[model samples]
Target chain A: MPRQVRLRRHPVGALAADDFHVVDVPMPEPRDGEVLVRNTWTSVDPAIRIRLAAVAPAGYFPAFGLDAPMDGIMAVGEVVESLAVGFESGDTVWHTYGWRDYAAVPAGAGALGALGSLRRLDTAVAPAHAYLGPLGPMGLTAYAGLFDVAELCAGDVVWVSAAAGAVGSLAAQFAKLRGHTVIGSAGSDDKVAFVLGELGLDAAFNYKRGAIEDQLRAAAPDGIDVYFDNVGGDHLRAALSVLRRWGRVAICGAVSQYERDRPAPGPDNLFQAVANDLTLRGFRGSSYTDRMDDMQRDVAAWLRAGVLRHRETVVEGLEQAPEALVRMLAGGTIGKTLVHIA
Target chain B: MPRQVRLRRHPVGALAADDFHVVDVPMPEPRDGEVLVRNTWTSVDPAIRIRLAAVAPAGYFPAFGLDAPMDGIMAVGEVVESLAVGFESGDTVWHTYGWRDYAAVPAGAGALGALGSLRRLDTAVAPAHAYLGPLGPMGLTAYAGLFDVAELCAGDVVWVSAAAGAVGSLAAQFAKLRGHTVIGSAGSDDKVAFVLGELGLDAAFNYKRGAIEDQLRAAAPDGIDVYFDNVGGDHLRAALSVLRRWGRVAICGAVSQYERDRPAPGPDNLFQAVANDLTLRGFRGSSYTDRMDDMQRDVAAWLRAGVLRHRETVVEGLEQAPEALVRMLAGGTIGKTLVHIA
Candidate 1:
């Protein structure tokens, strides 16, 4: 019997515990291009909330049917019975299966084989959970934003919002490695200190302390050339004020106002895009999947060479997934929030 | 002592005739490394109004001083005297020496020479006003926005705002040439009729008559792939609502709200960028000035061969420059508005 978490009802505002329910199901055999995966761990992200409500209905995979399994990106067990040629029994892999004890995944699903390069993750570089955090899609979101999207070059000044989050921490390090002067903003003084002292950011500020504009001005005295925007709102408006002419903004996420039912009151400074000839590009790392092999090769090399680092906050159990998400959404969890199923 | 117009004072809101002053002085001769140009025509654009307010203090050129000549893209006469050896007597040219009766332009000051293939204007294909309209920066702005900035391709559907304006009209024709479906919106029914019935636009509407969203939805039923934004504000919000996934918005101009002394309302649908993975790039035609040889070459060729068409609203005399700008800002003029000095 497979125990599955099913979406019993659609969420309107914040998701409640009753939105989902755990149910038992019978296991089924695999098809020609399918493999049965025993679920280990599932990855939860804010984008999941978007999938639950918005987006074109026909374009998205239909919502967890009433009384059916809730689907998501999951780290899975070896293929017990595989019709697909690539897998055999006892092999550990990841697939976008669902909130379930067992699932039948078709060939080529999830973040692809891109997640498996962590098999050789070095303890000296980053813990295993860090791979799922800074070195995973979240980390890559920062990397692509700072380098590929913002095109951060040596001697440029970089400012990152949500500085202690999974993506922001990695982005700071990447900017530092590229010889950029880095600054960050976080919700608490402790996280600010972590970014400044531990991560070696040139400057860090607690956004909760004062006005975001004054904080940003104090952090980036010279001016900001690149901004990795994870928290959009007043923070975005503040960054716009001090941005250098021809500045580049890499918009990875807008977690600051993501939970709102209606659009938040964001900055009125977008006119700077014209006055300063600025480029504000919103990038989705999923679009750059073809470059994953190259990213893994380069990032692994960087990790081994002691040029990069990552951190994670592990919650031990698939059952704790909901709680971890709540903690993450509440801004209580630091670094990458991960589930370690045993 | 070139006769020039100077910014006497910044306008509080609507620009008045007293905002600028024109003075007649003896023309100066070219010195070392300089070329003397007899000013023939000057472009009156919406951007000039932006320059007058000193709002956007930082752009390609320095801001207009409290009391100094406003220099921008201008069409001028040949070097009557040659201190710059490259340009000799009677060589007709165009340069950036605006708000002036005569200018001692430095060598390579908007210097564009004819390419061998381009058919030089001989009062046959169109009027001389075409150079300032479809054959000059306005044409290039449309071309670069459509082909370079947006990377629009054939079969792609384009939704252009301010469709009957100089750049927008050229953009519609250019998109048609590229085999793309083009839709446009203008302020009045006459402009809409001209764009749809005369210019061969796939569809067009008068945005002033009704809600922009309803008009956009009806025009672009399949969704907008490329949106060349000229009129920002509610039009931009409407475009964002109808843009397809991964749509490209070429932020060419925002003439709608340029007159405001205070900043306008924020784009309410900005979150759509994340949802659709859209790329919004704000660009200016001046940055790509090196392409003048190429643009003039192609545009001139197209004009002579009747492969391209354009319109001109000529306001004769340098004194009428302010009136031309006023007309443009009020959206009363179609195609390019030029100040013709006799």
Candidate 2:
């Protein structure tokens, strides 16, 4: 028997542990061309809250059905049984089936636009769990957002919202490493210290203190050239006001809106895009699978060189995955949040 | 004395005649490096509503002061005196000083980012009034928005909101002429008829007739690739829902938000941009003056070959400029709305 988490009910407002239930289920068999994975480390991303809605936003991942196994989450594990070619019984791997102990997944199929395709993990480059963070989707997200979507120009002034979170920390560091002026904004003063002291951003602010727009204006007196948006709503509004002419906003996620009982209307000042010749581009890490190799190569090299840093708030068991997600969404955890369920 | 239409007070809700007053002022004399012109035709654009606000959206043309000459409007006239270089008396010209019978304008000064700068017009290509419609700012707006901002790709199904109006009509026609399937959405059935019949768009819809989203889906059964957003709000919401993967939105203007008593929140489904890899880029025609020569060259040729069709909604005098704007904003008129002021 294997343990798994199921959606007990859709979250009404802030996600609570009561919204999910842990269940003991019989092991699933690997079909032809499928591999059985014993999930060891599963991701707890703020983006998952979007799927917990009754009906997910249009063009997003489908909503999680009531009393069903949660899927489409990133996980790293060991291949237990292989009916698929090129997969060995003992190889470490990553896939898009998580919040469960074991999964029977087809090798060639892609989840989240090939970002979560079943692939063998080169643990030589990084640890198995690293595939769930710095060397994996988060890394690709930060990389593609800065270099690909925002098109980071030389001498650009960059700002990362939720700067101590999974994707934000990496994006801020990448810009800093590239010798650009980088500012970070986080929910707590502790996270702001982490951004300034650990991640080494040029300026870091605690967004919980005062008016976001005023704080951003104070941090960047002149204005920002690029905004990596992880918190939508008021955060986006502030960015719109502080962004200079021809500014670019890479809309990675809207964590602030995800936990709300109802969807918040988008920023009122989106008209600023026209006023300042700005571009507000929304993107997902999964959308940029083509950049994964470059991201892994550079990020892994940085990690080995002690130039790139990663943090993970780990939970004890599969049953606590729901609690882990709630913690992550509330900004209670810094950097990546994960569940360890051998 | 030269008569000018000056702002009496900023409009509330909908623009009324009382918001503007016609005043007879002392005739302006050309200063050094200036041209004094007797204005002939002036433009009444939906975008002008933005400047009437207490503070216009940032990076936009500054808000018009109470009881001041409404600057930044496009007008064509004949130069009565040329104290500026390269300008001879009796030469036809265009400048930003509109809502007036006479203007003394500097030669090299720019307004609205140089889009409204004083420039001599080649009247032989088209009449002076045509410059205000198909050959002037409207044309540049349509061209720059489609080609530069949206980056229209081949086989792109295009949607233009406010499709029978000044900039919309030209954008729709340009896409149609370029052999792409174009859909036009207007407020009234007659305007829909104008879009389908006169503009030759592939599909046309009356947005007021049904749910905007459903109407857009019905018009573009297969999702649209490019959206020229002249009307922002529910119209933008409809576009976000119906736009396909990798779709693009050129935010040329947000007329729907301009006249509101207070600002409106942007579309709720802007997260669709991340889900579908969409890009929303805002721009003004003046932002791309370098494209002017190309636009004039192509548009002038089309006008000569009898392929490019244009219609003008003419108000009798400068005194009616406010009324013209009111009519245009209310969707009471089609194509270009102009005031014939001598």
Chain B TM-score against the true chain B, each candidate: 0.91, 0.98
**For each of the candidates, what fraction of the native contacts does it recover?**
0.33, 0.89
Error of 2 at B18 (Å): 1.8
Cα-based lDDT for every prediction = 0.72, 0.91
lDDT of 1 by residue, B195-223 (tens): 98778899999998899989888988889
TM-score of each: 0.86, 0.98
lDDT string for model 2 (B1-342, tens) is: 799888888787888877888899999988899999999999999888888877888888899998888888899999999998899999999999999999999999887788878888988788999989999999999999999999987999999999999999999999998889999999999999999998899999998899999988988888999999999999999999999988999999888887788889888888899888899999989999999999999999899999887878999988999888888888899999999986
Predicted structure with the largest DockQ when compared to the true one: 2
In TM-score terms, which candidate is top? 2
lDDT of 1 at B108: 46
Model 2 alpha-carbon miss at residue A171, Å: 0.9
Q: In model 1, how many backbone clashes occur?
A: 0
lDDT of 2 by residue, A1-342 (tens): 898899988878899987999888899999999999999999999889999989988788889898887879999999999999999999999998999999998999978789999999999988999999989999999999999999999989999999999999999999998999999999998999999999999998999899999999999999999999999889999999999999999999988888777667998888999999999898888989999999998998898999998988899889899988888887899988989987
Docking class of 2: high
Which consecutive 10 residues in model 1 chain B have the weakest lDDT in total? B111-120
